[model samples]
Target chain A: MAKENKEVLLQVQGLKQHFPIKGSRNVIRAVDGVSFDLYKGETLGLVGESGCGKSTTVRAIDQLYRPTAGNVLFEGVDLATLKQKPLIAARKNMQMVFQDPYGSLNPRMTVSQILSEPLQIYSQRKIINMTKEEISRRVDELMEIVGLSRFFKNRYPHEFSGGQKQRIGIGRALALNPKLLLLDEPVSALDVSIQAQVLNLLDDLQKEFDLTYLFIAHDLAVVEHISDRVAVMYLGIIAELSPANDLYVEPLHPYTQALLSAVPIPDPKIERTRERIVLEGDVPSPDTERHGCYFYDRCPKRMEKCKGSIPELKAVKGDHQVACFLYE
Target chain B: MENKTILEVKDLKTYFRTDAGIVKAVDGVSFRLDKGETLGLVGESGSGKSVTNMSIMKLIPMPPGKIVGGEVLLDGVDILKLNEKEMSRIRGNRISMIFQDPMTALNPYLRISTQLIETIRLHQGLDKAEARKKAIEMLKLVGIPAAERRIDAYPHQFSGGMRQRVMIAIALSCNPEILIADEPTTALDVTIQAQILDLIKDLSEKLETAVIMITHDLGVVAGMCDNVCVMYAGRIVERAPVDDLFESPKHPYTNGLIQSIPRLDEKGSGRLFSIDGQPPNVIDLPECCPFHPRCEKAMDVCTRKYPPVVSLEGKREVACWLYEENK
Candidate 1:
């Protein structure tokens, strides 16, 4: 697929999400300033470690948390400026799938009720009008779509395994046929074999429904496998953004290089001889204000200029963009 | 460096008597840990990797959970046969275990110094002053900055990575012969995980402490373990040298696990090869091969009976009908 040929489904322009401390004046710049474009029917992976604002990015885009600053252009309409009623209407096109399958689904409700709740609510709100029989039919279709047996519709969440519960969650997300799905570490909780199954199901679902996805995960390998393009986030900002293959093959940012090196390959032969870049300390607190680049203190390739000013994400190659002095 | 078996588990069976029926959590698991050698127990959730270790540690809650049969031989002494008092001496002094979540493992109310000193004092019979000094030293060894000053701080004061380091510090304070690390870095980030793994690798080599690493992540197993045991439905399905296991896996489950993970080195847009069906429930599990239903190359015999363990070349052993003829 050509890059320029695809239409932009969601455009996040200089998005910032900041939360102030209760008693203190200090603010946590969770998603300081992020900008990206989600193309139609494409999966854009947001990869980062914990507290890197990957989840916050998805939430801000989904309007779960109103952004502190900047615009979210969804289908050429500014979602950031929309009121509660209009925002609710805009959200019909987008839906979120959470990480923990055990916690996500309601244990009390059966699979049918769990899947139908979203449809019922959306229909009641006049987002989409559907008859009860049609709702029942759609629920059955969703079960088939996510590879769950329709016979298990009356079963409670506790009866289902972790993988089955995840399928139910996916089915519920697809109830209204949302154009975009915000997958926030959907398969992280699952076992390796089950993780593979879910990943493959997501791949098939995207193709079958023509749904766009903003996949957020800490696992680089999983993201690379699914994402068309990858964005590596660090301390609330994207350090590098490129085509999935290009980013993994030739990482531009030092953080991306270090992160890539840190992940141990499954093969013992490769893992034994491979040199890992083990970062010295933990990620710095997001609450602390910094004048320089977010990665300056921990960065191995830190320069004098990096401490004085922040580096803007700039394109260095055809599709690879990096926010580092080395690239500049 | 001659290889010597320090810990030998012989036909260990830990079962849980649930309302549904007897859940064979760790059913007849057997393996040997060489001195200073890192042995990886690789399995998914409820595959009995954790139960096997817990049973060895004698930490399983009885009544509901019971070690029905087994012999955990440590230096020719059957630790499983020992009384509660006798086992307590061997628990931390000889064989220390670290859990996945450090927060839950460490007492939040107690200061770092209290926990560290208590373990050191109990095992080494050291005084408070000497124990505190050794605690700081152990903390420093695990790469905790300002160990002397932070020794009084609570577990909540430190970050997740630092807290894990504290757990490691306490675990290794006694300089145990065998250290059982059960998913120590699973709760951490990739960068922090690398740091923790490197520390463990370096410390194990320095202290000559044998490590039994139990984890679901094959990447961790590949990096840390000299030998690997792939568990399935509370049984050791396959056992092999780390290199041979990844190079040429004999069991269908091991092969499926390796094929399933998206590789960091490999660049492919194609669909990942996923094993069909979920892991079997262990409660009242049939006598036949548990993984046969999900196995790609399951034979007719696999459904009728459990496959016998076949010894292959390079010290590898696999329990599968596909390799039964090789026996």
Candidate 2:
């Protein structure tokens, strides 16, 4: 966890993802001007509620969605400038695990087929040239690493449980031994018991492979558990960013404070006594053009200046950044 | 002194006649809801939490889903014995429900006013104009902005959070004695979920309605409910007050569930307490404790025979072989 010699594996700068409305000229700014640095072998969590553009940010970083602006530099190479073939080649070091285990995997294919299909397809890219026996052996190794029994590889996805299906998904993501793993709500779909199992597995795998993770999730608890550093996003921008512990303990931004407060802790005594800052309104539509702060309408400490100018993410405390007029 | 029991479920056994086998969806589930209280039915998917609620509502299809045995008492009267017409009268009037997804629960083709007014008129016997006014009031009560105008809008016109507010409006339109919300806020955001939960809590308190909240989230249970029932493989494994359940969970399955979830309060040690193995198949559950396979402290007797329910002090109860001697 030492930062002295840690290399920045993924440097995302001024990334913007805008979707054009079908009939109208207006566009939805799903991810607008977000930037972050993911250190090698350290997990950086992206936490936000629904429609806050956390998923879009991850997707843009994964190059699944072509960004409208800005650069995604993976080990100094700008991924946004790459063509389809080259991008595919670049994606070999970066893989993603989705939230829904049931929908992510192919239902028709057996687990063995699902695991091997990735290797077979990527082998055509010539990054991995393996014989049939080597492929089988690697597939089994992936399964074992993910804690899935090798004997259950022949079973269809439908036959396995939610946790098992997720393990298979993780196995497929790790099939190529990617340096960076983009986990988008990996454990959110599983049961609490199974979720913990998967979280522990993810932790062990991180150490075993030195995997740097962009752990994207809505659950604050899971994010705090898995992430070394955490970024709080709201309406397509980073509201606050700091070490995971510091962010949770003393959130600088009002949005981060409100979001952390809104999450109900399991302890009945603490929950009853804790003062929650429940925001009044829903997240505003991304289609609306705003000159001021995106969270101005809902911020508890909104000022007259917040209505006129957008606050940049400025450093407040040690390594902690906040985007608000109060911080300015 | 007898606490006024609004609803009581005794040995409820509901099964689905699937091609695979008779799936014991809700097997011998029992619980009680007092007047103006919230009871949390916590469980994973297929754990029979939803089915138990469906059985109480008489919403289960008879051919596929049959209530083989049970006594569901609403105000000391057994509702399971009631016919379809009588049950229909009870539903949406005395007992109402809000489903999981607001988008799917509300008809997209129909306007919000139409859905709300229809339920209002049918349940309250109000005139069309009067029902429309009442529907708008309900919507406003659930914090829908511009209720008078938004009432005429279709379900698609509203956001996910707003649609959920509409669902709450319809559910609370009749001001029923009991309200059953099945994963009501699961589809919404945390902030939105907080808003909806506050609305439900506030409305239930104001109306003095007993609520049966069926959800998979323990945090929601801790914040909202007075009592909690942890279910597994179609059986209630533990029943305790919310405070007791969270502080010192009794059953092994309950303990595993609490320890498994990462808490927002404190940092974890890079590992979580995990319950190994999947839940047992409901169709052919073992004669012993269904959780024995996954239980860390499972004994030989656990796999040999079913554990009896042990009632501890402070109204806590657990079904596990570890506490078998106390039964």
Candidate 3:
């Protein structure tokens, strides 16, 4: 957990992704001024409600959608400034596993073909040179690593169940031996039992490859389980960033507290007795320009200053940062 | 306070006639719902949790899907035997259902007023003015702000959570005795899900309506339901009180499911306990236990035949070979 010696694998500084509406002057700021440092071989969990820009943060970091502002420093190299060829070259070190496993995989292609597509593309582009046999061998290894049988390589994606399809997705992501993996709600679509399987597989794969992960998911329990550090986002901003235990055990931000309280504990004795902090109203649309806090409307501990100015994420305790006027 | 049994489902068998064979969607599923008590049906997809509730509502489509056997006893009357005309009177009047996706469940083109008023008028025999007044009241009851104005707006104007609130309003407008909410909070965010769940819990208690919450989330089941029914491949694998089910699950499948979920309260960095193998495909399923392939304590008898339901102490019921001796 020491930060002095650990390398920063990815440094996202003031990253912003904004989409403009057609025939309108308004822009929907999906990811606005988010900053974080993902340590090497560590899982940094990004959690929030839907439309809170959790997915957009990772997508923007992956350069799936070019950020409107700020820098994405992957291994000290600024991905935001990189040109098309250099960006593609840099992308070889980072791969993204999308949320929907069913939609991500091509229905027509066989499992082997799907897993090998990345390798073939990389080899064709001279990013990684490998013969057809080597690619096939790597696919087999990937299938094994992801706990899928090599015999199922000939089967199409449609033949696999949700969990199996997700395994295939994970196998495809690990095809090029990327140092960093951007998992965007990878296990959300699967069942609880299968979700655990994929989570364990991801944990093992990270250890096996020494991969740094920016795990994006809404399920807080899953995030707590896999992440070394957790970041709670709200309407394109990090409300709180702390160690997984600290964030869960002693959350500073009101939004974080409310979010944690909302997640029902599986134990009935605990769930029935616990006091929940249910926030009022829906998440405001991200389109309108906001000078004040994004969560001002629903924040239970809102003040006059909270309505006038946005709070900066500052350290209240050791390594525990919160964005609220109360902390100030 | 005495508990009154409101509905009793006996040996329900709902099947789908597919090209491959008959898919036993909800085979031999039975449970009892007491008045004002919340019951939970927890299972993964294709485990027939949703189908069981749909059969109770008589909403299953014909030709492909059919309720071949079983009786859905409401109060004292067997509703499965009721004709289409008779079932129509009972469908929305006495029993109501809210679906998973509020967006698709609601009619986009129709105004909220029209949808709410139509249901109220059809069931309660209220006139236009009274029904319109009652519709706004229903909307207000579900915590929709400015219900009078929002009632006139179309469904597209509302957010996902607000849309779900509207769905609840419509479902509970008639004050149905039994409310079946099928994954009501699945499509909602945690904050919004909390709001919806709180509203449902509060309103159900206020209206004295029994709720059958069908979801895959054990957390939701633990918090909301009085009794929990764990389903695995078209049959109830286990049934117990919520506390007992979580604390000491009898069925292997239920125990696996309870342990598999990463708990919010527990602090652990260890690898999650996951069940091996996938749920069996229900198409042309055999008479043997479907979960035996994934169960760790699977015996020779589990592969040969399905285990009979065994009633244990504390009113728990389990359909596994491990509990067969207690039968």
lDDT of 3 by residue, A1-328 (tens): 4467888989999999999999999999999899989899889999999999999889899888899999999999999989989899899999999889899999999999999999999899998899999999999999999998899999999999999999999899889889999999999999999999999999889888888899999999999999999999999999999999999999999999999999988999998898999888889999989999888999999999999999999999998999999998
Candidate 3 Cα outliers beyond 4 Å, as residue runs? A1-4
Model 3 clash pairs are none
lDDT of 2 by residue, B180-256 (tens): 99999998888888889999999999998889999999999989999999999898999999999999998988888
Report the lDDT tens digits of candidate 1 across residue range A215-272: 9999999999999999999999999999999999999898999999999899998998
Q: Could you tell me which 10 consecutive residues in candidate 1 chain A have the lowest summed lDDT?
A: A1-10
The number of clashing residue pairs in each candidate reads 0, 0, 0
Better candidate by DockQ, 1 or 3: 3
Tens digit per residue, CA lDDT, model 2, A1-328: 7677879999999999999999999999999899988899899999998888999998998889999999999999999999999888889999999999999999999888999987898887797898889899998998899998899989999998999999999999999889999999999998888899999999999998989999999999999999999999998999999999999889889999999998988888988898889897778899977899999989898999999999999889888888888876
Q: How close is candidate 3 to the true structure, as a TM-score?
A: 0.99
Per-model DockQ? 0.87, 0.84, 0.89
For residue A289, model 3's alpha carbon misses the true position, in angstroms, by 1.5
lDDT of 2: 0.91
Which scores greater on TM-score, model 1 or model 2? 1
- The stretch of ten residues in a row with the least summed lDDT in candidate 3 chain B is B318-327
Cα-based TM-score, every candidate = 0.99, 0.98, 0.99
